[model samples]
Target: MTQPKVTLVVSPRERFSYTRASLESIYANTDYPFDLVFVDVCSPESVQTYLKATSQSFKILRTDHYLSPNQARNVGLRYVLDHTDSQYVVFIENDVVVKRGWLTRLVNCAAETNASVVGPLTCIGNPAHQVIHNAGGQCYIKTDFKNGQARRRIKQSAYLTGRAVADVRDQLHRTPCDYVEFHCMLVRTDTFAMTGLLDEGMLATREHIDFCFMVAQTGGEIYNEREAVVTTDTLGLASNKAGLMARFGQLKLPDFQWSDLPYFMLRWSDRWDRASLDHLRQKWNLAEDKYFTKRYAGLGSRRHELLIQPIVQYLTFGKGSPWLEKLLISLERPFNNYWFNRYAQRFEQS
Candidate 1:
C-alpha cells in the first residue's frame, strides 16, 4: 500500500508546550510522509525564530497581521490546496499534539471507512485518568435557569465526547453529527474543496459546526477514531482575560433562536454555563443573555423584564435556578464579596 501524504496545517500566534511538543511528536513518530505548513498569523517572527533551529520540511507563511481563527484556517487551507498535492490534509490547532501512531491510525480508519473527514480523540491526561475533551462536536442545549436548577440531564457531549467506545459507535451508527472539532480533523482534499473552507462569518466559535453542517448537507461522512488520541495545548492564552473577552464578545448570535441556541450554548458554554463559570471563578459578562433580553424587550415592560430576568439572574450571580434568586437576596453581600475577590484576583493576574 502506498503511504498517504498528509499536510499538517498549524496556525500559531504565541508559543507553548503543545506547540513544540506537536512538532517534535510528528517529526519523531510519523510513519507516512507528510509536510508541515505553519500559518503564523501574529508574531510570525517569533515562530520563525523557533523554526530556524529545526530542519523539518515545513513552509512558514507569515502575515503582517493576525487572522481570526476562521480566516487563518481558510488561509492554511488555500495554501495546502495550492502548494501541496497531498492526498489528505490534517488541521491541528497549534495547541494540539498527535500521539504516537496517531496518523497511521487515522489514515487506516479513513481508508477503510472511506470517510470524507476523520478525527481522533482529544484528551487531557496524567495516566491517573485522562478525561476526554473533544471526541466530536455534539448538540448543545441551552437550559433555562429553572431547568438547570432542577438538575435534569442535558446533552453532555458537544458532539459525542465522554461516552464509552460502544456508545460512540452506537451514536455513529445512528447518524453522523453536525461536524467534529477542527483540531486533529482529517479531510480528503477533494471533499474539502467541494465543501469549501470554513465560514469566516463565525470567525472562531461554531465555525467548525458550520463547516461540518455543510459537509453533511453534501452527504459526506465524518468519523471519530476512538484509538487515536491528540492532546490539546490550550496554551497560556486560554487564561488571558482580554483574549477570552475578544473571542466571546465577537461571537454573533445565530439567525434561528431556539434552533441554534443549543449549539451556541455548547460553543460558548465555557463562558456562559453557570456551573462552568462558578468552578473557574469566571464571569461571562452575560452578553448573550443581555442581547436576547434586549431583543425581546419590546414584549412589554413588566412581561419583558420577567422573560429575560432568568438570564439576568444568571449573569449577576452564577446561578440560574429560581432558588438562586432567593439565595442571592438572602446572601447578597457575602456572594458579592466572594465574587469581588475573585474578580480582583483575575484582574490582578491579567
Candidate 2:
C-alpha cells in the first residue's frame, strides 16, 4: 500500500533548550517517511548552530524576532501549503519526543477513520512513557442565562491527567474527542480549507483549544489515536529544579538556560496571557465568569513557578520561603513587563 505523504512542522513550545533532544527523538523513533519543516524564532546561538548543522536533513525556517506559538505554527503551515502537496501536516512542538511507530499509528488512524485531525497519547516528565499529560479531552463553550444576560464560558478538560499510563493503557483506543493538544497533533492538510491558518491572536495560551474548537465548528472529525505516543519533557510539576533534583539520576532534565529567559518570559508574560484571553473571549463571545477570573488572577503563575521559583530555590539554598519567592517575583514583574513591551515594539517595527 502506498503511504500518504506527511509533512511534520515543528515549532518552539516554550523553550529552545530541548531542541536537540526533541529533534533527535523524532528522527530516531519515527520509522515512517515524512518531510520536516522546523520553525526557529529567535532561538539562542547554540540552538541556531545545531539547526544550521542539521539543515541539510530538513527545511529550517528562521525568524530574527520571537513569535508566539501559534504564529510559529502558522509560519510553517503556510510554507507547507504553498510549497508542498503533502496530504497530512503534523504540528509537533520542539519539546516533544516521539516513540517508535508513533507517526505510523497516527497516519493509520486518520486513514481508517477519515479523521480530519489525530493526536497521540501524550505523556510528560521522566520515565517518559509512564506518566500521562493528556490522553484526549473536552474543549467547548458553554452558555448560561442569568439576569437576562447570556453568560458563555469556555470549558476544557483533560482525560486521566497525571495518571500512570499503565493504569489506563487498556482503556485507551482511537476515539473521537472534543480536542487534543498541539504538543503533537496530525492535521489533514485539506482541513485548512475550512479552518484557515492558526489564529495568531492566541498568543500565549489556549491556542490548541481554540484551533480544535474551530475544527469542530467546521465539521471536522478529531480522533485520539492511543497507539501513537509522544512525551514532552517540560510540563506539569516535573519541570522545575526540585523535580530535577528528585529524579537526578534519570535522564538529564532539559535545561532552561539563562538566555532563554527573554523569550520564555515574553511567551508567558501577563500581557500576552491577558491579550490571548481577551481575544479568545471576544472571538467566541465567552463570558467573564469564574473560569476567566481564575485565569486572570493567575496570569503570571507559569513564569513564577517555572522561572522565579527555580532562581529563588537556588538563591535560598533550596530553602526558599514563600515570602521570599513572592518578593522576588514582585521585584521581577516590572522587568518582565518591560521586556514584553519592548518585544511587542520590535514586532511592530518589523
Candidate 3:
C-alpha cells in the first residue's frame, strides 16, 4: 500500500520544539515511508536555519510573506497536491508532541473509516500526564456582558470524550461537530478540492471550526480518535483570549450586578477599553474602583479568576440575590486567600 504523505505547516512567530519531536517520532514509529512537507509562513532567519537543519530529509517550502495560518494552510494544500501522490495528508502544528503510534493510529482510522477529516486528542498547557487541554472539537457559547464587557464561559467540548475510537466497527462514521482542532487532523487531498480550502477570513480564530463545519455540510465525516494523543503547546492561549475580545466589542450591563463580572472578565481583554472600566464603576456604583488595581493585588493576573466570578456567584446564589453579592464583597478576603493558596505558584511563575 502507498503510504500517506503528511504536511506540517509552521507559521512565522511561533516556536517549533515539540513539533519537531513529534515529526521525528512519526519518522521513527511509522512502519511505512511518508513524505513530510513544511510550509514556512513569514519565518525568521533563525527559524529558517532550524527548519533547514531539522527537516533536511523532508521537502521544505517557504512563502515570502506571512499568510495568516489559514492562508498558509491553503498554500500548503496546493503544494501537497502538486508534489505527492499519497492518499492522505495530515495537518499539524509546530508546538505539539505526538504519542507513540500516533501517526499509525490516525492513518489506520482514516483508512478503515475513510473519513474525510479525522482529529485526534489535541491537549495543550501541561502535557506529559495528558491532562486534556481540549479534545475533538469545541463550541463557543457567547453571552451578553452587561457593563461593556464580553465573556466566554465554559466552551462545549461537544464530541468524543475519553473513549478511544476503536476499529471501523466502532467509528462514529458521521458525527456532528462544530469544528475540529487543526493542530492534529487528517484529510484526503480530494476533500480540499471538493469542499474548498479553509476560510481565510476567520484567520486565527474559528478557522478550524469553519473547515470542519464545511466538511460536515458537504457529506463528509469527522471523527475524534481519543487514542491518538497529541500534546500542543498553548503558549498562544493568552493571545487567543486577547484576540476574541478585540474582535467582539464590549457587552453592556448595569453596574455592580452579578452578570457584570462575566463580561468584565472577558479574558483580560477588558484592559483595552477605558469604557469597560467606566462601566465597572457606573454599574457597581463603586468609587474609583479600577480593574487593574484589583487584578494586580495578587500575582500574575487575577484576571481569569475575576472573569469566573459570575459563574461562582451563580453557583452560590442561584438567582437574583442582592444579599449574595454583598456577601461576596464581604468575603472577598477569604476568597482571595483560598484561591491564592491553591494557585499561588502558577501565578507567581507567570
Give the alpha carbon lDDT tens digit for every residue of 1-350 in model 2: 77899999999888888899899999999999999999999899999999999999999999988899999999999999999999999999998988999999999999999999999999988768788888899887888899998898878888888899889878678878999999999999999999999999999988888899899999999999988999986543475755333244432223657677788888889998999999988999998888788999998998888767776666666787899888988888898899888888887988
Clashing pairs in 3: 146-252, 146-253, 147-253, 148-251, 149-251, 255-283, 255-284, 256-283, 256-284
Report the C-alpha lDDT of model 1 over 240-288, residue by residue, as the tens digit: 2112112354432111123322222222222222333232111212324
Point to the candidate with the largest lDDT. Answer: 2
Q: What is the lDDT of candidate 1?
A: 0.56
lDDT score, candidate 2, position 182: 94
TM-score of each: 0.58, 0.94, 0.56
Error of 2 at 31 (Å): 1.1
For residues 1-350, write the lDDT of model 3, one tens digit per residue: 55566554443213332344555655665554467777765355655677788876777778754445666677777777777776777787765666776677777777778788877766554424144544565654345454886543324455544333332235443343455687777887789777877765543433565577577667888776666777665433422332222114443111122322222222123222233334333432334323324532432133333333443334444343557554554565455445434443554565
Distance from true position, residue 16, model 3, in Å? 4.8
Residue pairs whose backbone atoms clash in candidate 1: 95-233, 137-158, 137-159, 138-158, 138-159, 140-262
Better of 1 and 2 by TM-score: 2
Residue 259, candidate 2: C-alpha displacement in angstroms: 1.8
Name the lDDT value of residue 292 in candidate 2.
85
TM-score, model 1 to reference: 0.58
